[model samples]
Structures are given as C-alpha cells and as structure tokens.
Target: MSLRDMNCTFSPAALDAPDVASLLAELDGWAISGARLERRFALRDYHETIAFVNALAWMTHQQDHHPDLLVTYNSCTVSYCTHSAGGSLTNNDFICAAKADALYAQRAGA
Candidate 1:
C-alpha cells in the first residue's frame, strides 16, 4: 500500500539516513532539513492558507500525529518529526507527508 493509505501506529524507532533519503524521493515538494520532513504550500491568500491548515489539522488529528506548522498570509510550512522517537524522523513522518501531499493536491487543485 502507499504511504498515505497506511495508518500511523505507535513506533518508537527512528528511520535511518538512507531510508529517509529513499522515502523523501517519493514525496513531492518535501525535503529533509536536519531531522524533520518539511514542505511549504503556497496558497492564494490568507483564507486559503487557513483553510488548508484546518483541513491538515483534522487529518493529522485523526492520525494522532501532529506537525509543526508555520502559517503565513499565503503559505504554510509544515515540518514533521517523531518526538516519541527522540525527535528523529520516523515512518510516521513519511506516511503523514504523503497524506499532506494528497491534501494539498485536492485543496490546491494542482
């Protein structure tokens, strides 16, 4: 199954550098900066940005995995790392990253 199709369960292990790099390739507009998987979505305006944030919030809430979001007037920067795994990047990060990409695609119609 695709990452987005999979659910995030409790995992205490962090992904290794090679695994993280491989998974990062499967995600669009996402990059690895330190231990976090990061992406920035550019929206038309504040309204769209907030809408995207709220939608993403709900999705993450359902998965029980929250991301650090930097919101602005026209963009939202999302960063994900597993605090439960000692702030390292885990499989949950990539799974949620794929879901976030799907959300952005549907919301932005891109």
Candidate 2:
C-alpha cells in the first residue's frame, strides 16, 4: 500500500539511512533534515498559506501524527519525526509526508 493509505501506529523502531532513502523514493519533495522528514509548500498568498495549513492540520489530526509547521506569507515547511521511535525518522513520518504531498497537490491543482 502507498504511504498515504497507511496510518500512524505504535512504531518504536527507527529507520536507518538506507531504509529512509528507499522510502523517500516513494514520496515527493520530502527530504531528511537531521532526524526529521521535511517539505516546504509554496502557496499563492498568506490567505492560501493559512488555508492550506488548516487543511493539513485536519488531515494530520485524523492520523494522530502532527508535524512541526513553519508558516510564512507564502510558504509552510512541515517537518515530521516520531519521538516514540527514539526521536528519529519512522514509518509514521513517511506516511505523513506522503499525505502532505497529496494535500498540497490537491491545492496546487497538480
């Protein structure tokens, strides 16, 4: 199944570099920053940015996996890392990343 279809669970195991790389291939625009999976979405304006944030928030809230959000006038950078998995990248991070991509794509008409 695609990561977007996967839900966050009690994952105590962290992913290694090789595994992270392979999973990254399944996602778009996300990259490893330290121990987190991050991606920045550029929107049209502040209104659009906040609207996107709200939409993303709703989706992530359903998954029960929240990401660190850095929002500006036209962009929002989302970073995800599972603290339950030793503060490193986990399958939860990748799953959320894929969902983020889908959300952004819908907003961007891609």
Candidate 3:
C-alpha cells in the first residue's frame, strides 16, 4: 500500500519481514534494524540537521506517529516501530519513512 493510504490507527498484526522488506525497498536510505525501520540523514551542518528534525517533527505530529530521533552535529538517525504491535514493524513505520524521505528530498532539491 502507498504511504498516503496508511493511517495512524494501523492494525497490530505487524507486517512480516518479507512484507516489510518490500516496503523498505521503496523508502530511500531506510533499513530494517531487527523490528524497527531505521535511517540516518547526513545534513550539511547542525542548522540543517535541526531544520530536518523540525520538519520531521511536524510531519510526525500530523501523522500521530513519531520515531526515535538521534541528533548530532550534522546527522540524525530515525528509528520507527509500532509500540502497539509489541514493538514490531508495521505499515505505519514505512509510511512515516516514506514521508520523511520526501521531506528530505524536497529540502535537498531546494
């Protein structure tokens, strides 16, 4: 399913690794780290890093699906999973990953 088709109220069935693998392929710079979908964004500097993080925060807030963010001087690592699914990966994770990719791409293109 497309990321736009996903909602915050995802069923807790937890997509299997194979299914998650397919979804991950469509998300740029994202990887499956055990049961979590993870990605690291390397920005030009701390300012860019924070801008990316704030953009991501706004997106997550709108979606009501937040990821764990690890911020540094010039990078941020985002990790996502469904706590409702016993900490398993779900479509919501991939959905947010896709949105995050688009946000980063747009920033880069600008």
Candidate 4:
C-alpha cells in the first residue's frame, strides 16, 4: 500500500504479517516491533523536540489516531498500535506513521 499521498482516518483492522511487511517497506524510519510500528527521531533541541511533539499531537488528532510517544531532550520515539485490532498492526498505525514522517520533514525544512 502507498501511504505517501494518503489523507484519511484510521479504521482499525488487524493486518497479517505479510501485509504488514509490505506496508512497512514504504514507510521511512519506521519498523515493526512486536505488534507496533515504531520510529525514532532526533530533533535539534529541547524546544524543537517539544514543538515536534505538539505538531504530532495535532496531526494525530486530525487523523483520529494516536501513538505512544517517548520524548527526551532532543529525541522522540513514536510507537503505533491499534488496540481495537487486538493490539496488532493496522492501517491506522501506518497512516499515522506516514503523517508523523511528514510532520518531521516539514519541521526539518523550516
């Protein structure tokens, strides 16, 4: 599935291992760990890190999907999994992962 041009909501459905593998290929900086999609990003500073988190919060809200975020002084680790899908990988996870990547790119360009 191509997620680059996607703009949609997260409808939860469990993905099989093969399907998850195919989708993960198209997502940069993201990997499947256990049942979740995970990505780690290093930002410029504490301020930038928080800014990134805030931006991500807004984006996830708009998509109606959320990820587990771990924030440090200059780093963020985002983990996505759908509880509705019995804690498995879903399109929502990849969709939000793609959106998070876009937000990071925009921040980097600025």
> Which candidate's lDDT is highest?
1
lDDT-based ranking: 1, 2, 3, 4
Off by over 4 Å in 4: 8-11, 108-110
In candidate 3, which residue pairs get closer than 3 Å at backbone N, Cα or C atoms, i.e. clash? Answer: none
Scored by TM-score, the top model is 1
lDDT of 4 at 24: 91
Candidate 4: residue pairs that collide: none
TM-scores of all candidate predictions against the true structure: 0.95, 0.93, 0.89, 0.91
Expressed as tens digits, the lDDT of each residue in 66-105 for candidate 1 is: 9999999999999999999999999899999999988998
Could you tell me how far off, in angstroms, the CA of residue 27 lies in candidate 2 after the best superposition?
1.3
**What local distance difference test score does each model get?**
0.92, 0.89, 0.86, 0.85
Worst 10 residues of 2 by lDDT: 101-110
Indicate the worst ten consecutive residues by lDDT in candidate 4.
1-10
lDDT of 2 at 99: 89
Candidate 1 regions with alpha-carbon error over 4 angstroms: 108-110
Native-referenced Cα lDDT, model 1: 0.92
Candidate 2, residues 43-98, lDDT tens digits: the string is 99998899899999999999888999999999999999997777899888898889
Give the TM-score comparing model 3 with the true structure, all chains together.
Answer: 0.89
lDDT for predicted candidate 2 compared with the true structure:
0.89
